[model samples]
Target: MKNLGARTGFLITLGLVSLCLAPCQAQTQGSGTKSTTASAIFPNGEKGSAQTFTGTVWVQNLVATDSIYQLASGSVTFEPGARSFWHSHPSGQILLVTDGVGYHQLKGEPRQTIRKGDVVKCPPKIPHWHGASADSPMTHIHIVPNTEKGIVNWLQAVTDAEYHGAR
Candidate 1:
């Protein structure tokens, strides 16, 4: 009876181990879709592993609407000295800073230093831009919506002269 119990325990442990490994395998293989070498080269968490571009880069189609209301959310990572072009939202937008330091400015207002844990609201139709400072990388989640006339209207990039002006 003791030997039988030991065998059962060993089998259970093996089963648990396999279960734990299965998810990791699935993640590495992706959602059965094509995966690039870049994903394999850098796992989820690696310093400077995120794709960096000179211009603005956003995660597309991250949000969806439900039966009741729409949900829109996206992640934007700004490299040092990178900022978005002037833009406004038809229904406004919200930002939740997730990493590093940055700045946000609304039309006709002084730039404000934004840090991790800060939540910023951009009023409807107010032109603005937010991005990493000249010396640091920044990351934030942008939440907006799909509306009748669309949520955002993007315009020209923020000029260097405009960005460096006194805050």
Candidate 2:
């Protein structure tokens, strides 16, 4: 009787594990016509230019537009005290926080602290900047939808006073 109970418990656990992994497997497998696992992974990102950023920042392109979608996405990493210059997306932007702590601020507004798992939506043409906090490195996935106008409009750099004020 005890052996039967143990076998039942093991089966239940195995079923639960399979259920948990099913979605992941499905995502990689895709439909018979298409494979979703065709996306490329960039381990080391390219350095962000100093002209548009402060300190050290790296960006890795993840997904680029195809015939079906006019969107581009990338993972950006910011070192301590690093940040992007004020900019805006023509069609809007989404930032998905993946690690560490950071800050986001819209023009003329107070800075907001952002941590892992936070999702920030910046409306179309709304000037803003985001970056790692003064003491920590931060990483986020940035999604920008391409519009007829363009993806982004670069603006002035965030002043040192502004960055320090957030801390």
Candidate 3:
């Protein structure tokens, strides 16, 4: 009889905990059309875990949502000799290099080596690409404005010839 009573009490406690959490979960997913401000209504949740691809590259998307224009922010890690495709943003981009060395270039200009503590801004509608150098991995935070039209407009892949062409 004592064991039965203990089992019943445990089940009741579990039910109560579930009931408490259900509302919070629902609010997180279904708080749309509320009059509350965006920041007040939606607190920034924790960023998702890092994802590393087969190449020595990793990315963590910090923010990407339908209703936000502050844009999609992410951290990109590039392996030595790895680079992104030639790309441009509708509203420009900002990059902060956190570690190692890399290269960045706007089209029609010389590529520049980027080191730690460097902050780069690619002007709106400019064609540019950034990535790890031939001998060092580079990590940078990328910020691109989110737009109702499109955030990123990708062009051809960054050719190895272009990546290694000049300083």
Using lDDT, give the best candidate's number. Answer: 2
Across 1-167, the per-residue lDDT of candidate 1 in tens digits comes to 99999999999999999999988887766745432222232222322212323243444345554544564666676667777777898888999887667888898898888987899999889999888788765677788864654677886667776667554
The residue pairs in collision within model 3 are none
Q: Write the per-residue lDDT of candidate 3 for residues 1-167, one digit (tens) a residue.
A: 99999999999999999999988886677555332222132222333222312234556676674574657887777767777777788889999887678999999998888987899999888888888888877778888775554677777766677788653
* Highest-TM-score candidate: 2
lDDT of each: 0.70, 0.84, 0.72
Candidate 2: tens digits of C-alpha lDDT, residues 92-127: 999998877899998888999999899999999999
- List the candidate 2 regions with Cα displacement exceeding 4 Å: 1-42
Q: Stretches of candidate 1 above 4 Å error?
A: 1-61, 65-68
**List of clashing residue pairs for candidate 2:** none
Error of 1 at 17 (Å): 20
In model 3, which runs have C-alpha deviations exceeding 4 angstroms?
Answer: 1-55
